[model samples]
Target: MKRFYIYLLAFLLPVCCLAQETVIIKRKLTNAVKERVSVLKSDNVTKQGLYQALWDSKTVLANGSYTKNVKTGIWNFYDTKNNVIQRFNYTTNTLLYEAPEDSATNCRYVVDHTVRDTDRTTKPIVIGGRFFGYINYLRLFRLPPDMRNINNEVVVPTIELLVSPGGRLAEYIVHFQAENYDRKVGFNIDYLSDEDKTFIPATINGEPIACRIFIRCFLTSGGDLDLF
Candidate 1:
């Protein structure tokens, strides 16, 4: 047992030392437009790096990984706002999967209390953002601006959203209340993101699957947001 622990540490130490890799830099590929090299992370093993060409400072333009000095893992290309417009997964320098802008990260998801298994087909695995991440996503939800502008009166909104199979948001329905916001409230959904208008998507056998969830919001005139 002690020898096994010693061997495990020996194998892990080199990988740990490789974690503090350096970033590389280059210049002058503005294209016909004004694109420039922004940030880069290089692998010392192959002396190669991944470059993110950013026209804007806040957004990542493109990102990918390299294995054995070849581009591997998931590469994401973003637009001006840093939203991923394209995503491609590469393994051994081969394209494994690719997704266009409109269909990437747009689906919402829900939680499943049941565990399912398949014989010849495995369940879809939720990648990118994992399924349980929706809890933190919901913690970030806030009342919409129009709903919050209600003259300091109580506001209640019942929201229902659909999570598509691609782990993106499908649609949302919200019913706004006026001044009488002091109503009963309970939340049965898994998670909420972007102010109760979006959600996380679940996957079946490693693919995004669709699900529905509800959000009960109780905005009080007492200057506090009460939700369960």
Candidate 2:
């Protein structure tokens, strides 16, 4: 009887340890975004549970789950105002829902302005969705040393992204204007990561086409860039 009890305890120990092996990690992302990831350590460390990205450490920007580090099931992405902007299903590779395009919100333009308004057009979008893409942009953007402190004045800056039909970033330009400052900065796209350069190319009349995306942002006195 003692040998049998010992064998049973040994058999259950590994299972109990595995059940409690879940690890939670929290980290800060660019622009005050917070990421909380739950991973499981078994044969290897894998993200196997809830994943959340919060904006400003409070508003939920993204909420989803992962299996084997791949996004699975439905994922919800929200705007800074906490409104659901997109719903995607990674398991099925489907865009379940996307908010209607509002020109007042984001700027978009086709490379060829000759396209008629009646034509069906879709704007280019970053590969990993908007929240992550915005975060990446914030992480890479660096303010010029002289422009870092605005002294409570609002400074408008425009970021232009020229995307090719192949979904590559052909050109990146930044335009800044203030009381006595007017500068245009261009970056070599080759220096950017492949993931950053890739996007879902814009389409016109069901055909892929090159386009330009303009992101309007303002620099606060605190030196933080806020997108409109």
Candidate 3:
């Protein structure tokens, strides 16, 4: 055990020593765009260094290698408002991660969840605003925003997914008090067809809480179910 600790320390010490201590500059790409570059942990200290890039004060790319201060490999890019525009993933000389498949059923759900463009229960109905547009139906029912907080003082929201025979689609219901910022967003997702309903259990920190759920429901044309 003592020998193991010594070996571990020896291996990590160099990494710690080579870590860059601060951000040297924050540059604006344009009136609406801002970015920062900072030196961070780097491998191959003798020949290379690594740096991190931030857009709109958000760390979009990290551990970017530089050969004698020349940028190399994959780097992240952001939009003018600091939203992630594209991710450049590089390994030697190849590209991975293909764009999502396009299908009539799939496209409908995509717009329903992520963009909340339309409600699945009601055909040709659209909902506008944040959490609107399309989303992956299989992955709907997101946890409360406060659930991410480390303090654990806030209450987490619960989600339930349901599918119906009429729509032949998936839907979700979120249950939680509004005090903790509990809000519901539904989507069409991929899942097993055999199960009509599913209740997934989750937690917020150590306290027991149901966070998100994924389910399917039925949808029929000529019905207007968009209540709001």
Candidate 4:
């Protein structure tokens, strides 16, 4: 009887220790492309899949934390595999910022969002061009109801570019013109400092990029906003 009890104790001890050991489950990766849909499907994870996901979440930046915040403010959104998905200028409230300009002046302007399709992939990836995420305009000087304003139908110019290692934009080029309000310019209006509003960078065709926007608007000689 003593020998049998000893044997049973030895067998149960290893079993109990094995049971207490942490078992890591893993999962496999599937499609990495971002397909826009009316409704997104819930991701189904498997044990192997989870393992691959854990490995992928590791950050490339050695000094940064792998765990990201519920990042508000300006953020470049990437997938679990680290491919940039989109760019966002998030805010908790309807926060307003200055329209970028060299000088301060009131003008009529229209905001337009742009998207770009890049050909650097096996298939073209649709990264957002600058201004893809959000668009807004302001009448620094309110226009009179009867005044014909040029911003009503002006085409604004914009440039898209990538940042270089030298902290400057590389291969920077104008991407597209933004649609203007339904009006025309009567005269060559002069602009003041602080009258330009630049849009935050967006991903076009899946790659991150930046842009420069020229706000097209009509400013009366007397500093009144006019829609042309």
Off by over 4 Å in 3: 1-16, 40-74, 78-85, 97-228
RMSD of each: 17.2, 4.1, 20.3, 18.7
Q: Candidate 1 at residue 59, lDDT?
A: 47
Better of 2 and 4 by lDDT: 2
The sequence of per-residue lDDT tens digits that candidate 4 reaches over residues 49-99 is 111122123521011111122223443433333444444343342223322
Report clashes for each candidate as comma-separated counts.
Answer: 22, 0, 31, 37
lDDT of 3: 0.34
Give the winner by lDDT: 1 or 4.
Answer: 1
- TM-score for all predictions? 0.29, 0.76, 0.25, 0.19
In the range 1-228, model 3's lDDT, one tens digit per residue, is 999999999999999986555434455432222334443334323224445444335534223455554556764443223443334443352222222222422222222233233422222211110011112221333434444432222333333443232223345554343464544544435453322232222222322232222212222122111111
Instruction: Compose the digit string of candidate 1's lDDT tens values, residues 89-141.
Output: 64633333334324343333354535456512222222222212122333434
lDDT score, residue 23, model 4?
Answer: 30
Candidate 4 least-lDDT 10 residues: 60-69
- Global lDDT of each candidate: 0.45, 0.75, 0.34, 0.29
Encode model 2's per-residue lDDT on 94-170: one tens digit a residue: 77877765656755565775778798888887744555565666555666677666543545777788999988889
TM-score of 1: 0.29
Instruction: Give the Å shift of residue 225 in candidate 4.
Output: 4.9
lDDT of 2 at 50: 93
Ten contiguous residues with the weakest lDDT in model 3? 125-134
